[model samples]
Target: MSQKSAPRPPKTSPDATRRSEKSRRAIYAAALELVGEVGYAKTTIEGIAARAGVGKQTIYRWWSAKADVLLEAFLDLGEQAAEQAAGPGAEYGIPDTGDLAADLKAVLRATVDELLDPRFEVPSRALAAEGVVNEELGREFVAKLLDPSLQLYVRRLRSAQDAGQVRPEVDPRIALELFVSPLAQRWLQHTGPISYAYTDTLVDYALYGLAPR
Candidate 1:
């Protein structure tokens, strides 16, 4: 008997690859827009497929649930924002310019701008509201989406410590909250105006401490 050969891997054409990417982005855009407009509970995979102008099978092939789709979509959106702010090839991380305060201010000012973006704000609010009531999603999204960004702060703070800008004994994770929490509360509560100036002041207070030197 002749020996059997292993099956060859399927090859995809460049045009086909481009088409796949286009469809994926369309799905992400549709998912975000729908969730923002209707809230997560009301948003459906079918709706996303329809808005994306792709078959339901296309979405099903890529994502098992609306949550998964939204998760990836938000991640992609963040990447796009980073690219716009930091230029092409920008991966998400805090920029260290040796001057920790100036670097923090730059990042936070970008954050202030992001909060004001309608494309980001609406869908984010929907997801955040859901996370508030749904404990599982709350933990999941926080861990997956929010924690990465928080860790970047940790990394930056640790670097600051190495440079003697921050106290060596300080916990980078906890120390970051001094600046981050105030901005988070303002955006979530809509209790105060958010601006670069406000974030700059927060950074000043956080880095130098509220007491006099």
Candidate 2:
């Protein structure tokens, strides 16, 4: 068997790290803002570079295409959202406080907050609307931006399964969507109002289901 590789060294200097962080933040903000203002069709690497006040070569040095830039920018948006919305030491992972209902409620509530934030909402809707008509971009977006969060639900549901809260035969992936998809649909389609009450009901409905449990 191949031996385990050695761990990589940590970032050494605070200044270098800060510079990297600043550049990354600027790029993400520029991408999101540009997409929001101009829509995805008009969004370009050059536009992001201009909005970010960075050289075009700098963006090219980091990402190959506009899609990559937007996707990574969305990912960075998620990071910033979590940081601002969640408490210190909290992360994107599912809460495992042992009360599955509470954890789900907390997460959904936070998601409701994020979906309402203009910083996240505008760009996301622009991209999502484009995805509705663009198959390749849709799949790519789902794979990178969406699947990671879905996996966290999988983990939480798996734990609930182990604890005899969720049924063993239930597919965690689909079960998670029973709640997730509804909210996403509501937000993306303007099908209904997204609120804490809405999400709280979603958690209850997903767990007990709509079959009068």
Candidate 3:
């Protein structure tokens, strides 16, 4: 009896791989640019496909919806930024030098630089504004993007508590908002200028009480 023939692997080549990578980068760039220019409400799968010079089917092959595309695009942007900041293959995390204050300052200063970067700023602002009003999008944004970063702060603060740098009773989740929320408000509301100096001051005030010892 003849054995059933083995299934052939789907065709692929180096050139095809290169083209796929190129198309993906174009889609990501187009999505970010469109969001920055027109805001999220106006950004659509068709627009992204037209801007990227790819068929909408190309996008649909990978993502089910515009939100998925935009979310993944933002994630890719963040990964690129992290690699640039920390070097290729470097894991992203807060440093736990015995000096909690110094570590916090360093992180917040980096945050200031990231916030001021136009590539990150404009598209991020668009998404942030949308998330404020779109409850479903807001939940996804928090779950996928915002909460992971916040948890990093929570982990760092917990470390500080273990080291006696923070109060044992303090909730790391809430404690983090002391520094994080103010910077967010300032940036989101355009209430004040954001700078390394400003973030450093935030670290100080969050760690130290307003009243004198």
Write down the TM-score of every candidate: 0.93, 0.88, 0.93
Worst 10 residues of 3 by lDDT: 2-11
Q: Give Cα distance to truth, residue 124, candidate 3, Å.
A: 0.5
lDDT of 2: 0.90
After aligning candidate 2 to the native by TM-score, how far in Å is the CA of 172 from where it should be? 0.7
Candidate 1 regions with alpha-carbon error over 4 angstroms: 1-10
Model 2, backbone clash pairs (residues 3+ apart or across chains), number: 0
Task: Name every residue pair that clashes in candidate 2.
Answer: none
Q: Model 3: residues >4 Å from true position, as ranges?
A: 1-11
Q: How close is candidate 1 to the true structure, as a TM-score?
A: 0.93
Weakest lDDT window of 10 consecutive positions for candidate 2: 83-92
Instruction: Give the clashing pairs for model 3.
Output: none
Candidate 3 per-residue lDDT, tens place, 42-116, comes to 999999999999999999988899999999899999888888999997888788888998998888888888899
lDDT (Cα, tens digit) per residue for candidate 2, span 1-213: 978698665766999778767887899899999899989999999999988988999899779999999998898778867877676556668789989999999999989988998988999999998999999999999999999999999999999999999989999999998889999999999998999998899899888877864
Q: What local lDDT does model 3 show for residue 32? A: 95
Ordering by lDDT: 1, 3, 2
Name model 2 segments beyond 4 Å from true: 1-20
